[model samples]
Target: MTKILVVEDESAIRSFIAVNLRRQGYDPVEAASGEEALAVMEQQQDIAVAILDVMLPGMDGFAVCRALRERFPAMGMVMLTAKGQEQDKVQGLQLGADDYVVKPFSPKELLARIESLLRRLERPTVELGSRQEASFTSGPFIMRPDQRKFYKDSREIELTPREFAIIKLFMENPKVALSRDDVLNSVWGKNYIGDLKTVDVNIRRIRQKIEDKPEDPKYIQSIWGYGYRWLGGD
Candidate 1:
């Protein structure tokens, strides 16, 4: 059973989420604040996912999500915010959150989002029977599917789970022009509901990490008004 970290200052909402999580057979570890959530995570290293409230007491959910991504790149993150504004959702995703739920969200919707995140996290294997190789190589990039490891110019690049998925999708389908919708459907899951610009934000982040010059990216190129395509040489 994967343990879930629930971080919310409001006692009633915290308990409500924990109870629902329990009903769904998830073991939820609760925390009343961002600081306490970090402490809890330190004691419990097995936490697979963290449900973070944007309106945290001190650190705030954006900061927490950023911190947690650095500390545990593999762990999944979902942001909970009362605001349904597109900017809030975009900011959370930019900070490495896997998903976001507006406050007063249906329990079923929340659980479904959680399950989607978990499923993506568990994708530890990518079979390539036809091309027997230790890793997939394109230009200066090398990806070890089994290890979820990525390297550029022979230097390893640390990636959040979301970033990893986005990069892998591009690497696997090099030269194919993929629209924002295509990227979102492939990386964020088909059920994801958000602005198409979310894909652009993620792509920009990935470019910064992997490209020699993000301003003039060599591998990822925008196709005028259509979308983006990978130019990495195989």
Candidate 2:
């Protein structure tokens, strides 16, 4: 069964979410703090998604999100932040969270958001038998869809699942300027409701990984008012 890790310092909220998750036919793993969340992940191998609160006892949600993202690139992460705090939502996304639910959200709203994220997670990057091989090469970069990894100049570059998705999308449509909305819909799912700034954050993160100088990127080029385009070399 698919398990979801709910990490919240407040027992009341944690229990509420767990109960709802159970009702939704999903297994819930509860944790009172970030440390416990990490421990739970280590012990439970079936955790597919994590719902983390922005405020925690020990490590904050942003820190925990970054840590979990590094360890589990494919795991879906959703942060719970105070309503109306746009900065918190942006921070969570910058730390590689897949989605965020503001505080005071209804159970129905939260479940809907989780369902959207899960749909994205379950979506295959590339359908089998549609391609000759699960790989692509452009310029100095080489990607293997089967491995979900990136390589530049034959050197491995670590990328989160979202990062990998964005890179793949750009690579497949090189020289085309993709709008932020296009990227959000394609990568985060059409039902995703969040700041479009997330595209900027992930793009910056990708440049830091694949570019020699992130300040002056050569591959993913910004189009000012539009969005970005992949500049693949010969």
Candidate 3:
């Protein structure tokens, strides 16, 4: 059974989520604080997903999310933010979380988000008769989809799974102005329920990693009123 970590200070809420997860056949490991969550992660390295509540007693979910992202790049994460906390949502995404669910969210919605994330994280396989995937090269950057590795100027840049997917999409469609919907659909799936600003936040995070000047991005250019375009080549 897949294991999911639920870190929420409120015991009632945490228990509620755990029960729902268990009903869906997931083994949920519960924690009451960020510190405990990290400890749980240390002991259970095989945990597939973490659902972190933003308002915690200590350390807070954002900090925990950052720590988890740095320690386990491939593990999926979903932030639980209070409804109307727009900044919290953006901060979680910027900190490498795959998705966010507002408080007062239904179990169905939460499960859907988790299911979508798991789908995104699933490793791709090459069939016996299929051609091997090729590496993408854009100027100094190289991305190997099969290896799930990305490098710039011979230096490897660590990226979350979502970040990798977004960059791969941009590289695959170089010089084309892709609308926000295009990116959201390609990376987050068409059934994703969230703000379009999620796309902008993710793009900003990517620029910080790849651009020398994120304030004035060179490779990932903004299309203004549309979305963004990738400008990279030999």
Candidate 4:
């Protein structure tokens, strides 16, 4: 049986997911906080995935994720943060999170993202071993996808995971316009149900970090009615 762990504070949300995972034939374990999670995790082995909420009363989700990875490096981690907590989710990635699902998430969508993460984890890392190759360069920016880091003209730029993912997307497809929906589905996950403005906010944050003049960005060019694109300078 595939074991899964859910660390959420809310009783309803925790139970909701637990019941659903059980229905799907998964051996689900629930913990209300990071402390509780630790106590339970030791007893459970082969836990394939974990769904964790960002804010807990004590030992927030970020710390818990790191501890979990130390023990089960291969375990998939899905983070849940509030609607406006982009920074929190971004920080979570540094600790080795596989994916994130923002708050007000439907149980179904949560399950789907979980399944996708688990499936991706299921793939043998053999082909991925030692061969974790990635190379892409953008205007004034250097990308290391495997490491999820970005540098501007050799100066390291601290990009939030969301910012890094968005910038990476534009870099991979420079000069190609992408709509808000496209970005949401790709970076935020298709299960994202947040407002479109969330994209704009993240864009503004990224521009501030990458653009020489965020007030009038050149690389992350806006497309008016369409969206934005990375026009790497020549």
lDDT of each: 0.86, 0.86, 0.93, 0.77
Encode model 1's per-residue lDDT on 23-70: one tens digit a residue: 999999999999999999899999999999998888998999888998
TM-score of 3: 0.96
Model 3: CA > 4 A from native? 126-131
How big is the positional error of residue 73 in model 1, measured in Å on the Cα after superposition? 1.2
Highest-TM-score candidate: 3
Q: Can you give the TM-score per candidate against the true fold? A: 0.92, 0.91, 0.96, 0.57
Model 1 TM-score is 0.92
Q: Model 3, 82-185: lDDT tens per residue?
A: 98999999999999999999989999999999998887777644554676578899998999888888999989999888898899999999999999999999
Stretches > 4 Å off in candidate 1? 126-134
CA displacement after TM-score superposition, residue 220 of candidate 1 (Å): 1.0
Model 4 / residue 92 / CA error / Å: 12
RMSD of each: 2.1, 2.1, 1.4, 6.3
Summarize candidate 4's per-residue lDDT along 191-221 as a digit string, tens digits.
6555576677778767777789999888888
Model 2 lDDT per residue over 76-114, tens place: 898999989989988888788877888898899889888
Per-residue error for 137 in candidate 2, Å, reads: 1.2
lDDT of 3: 0.93
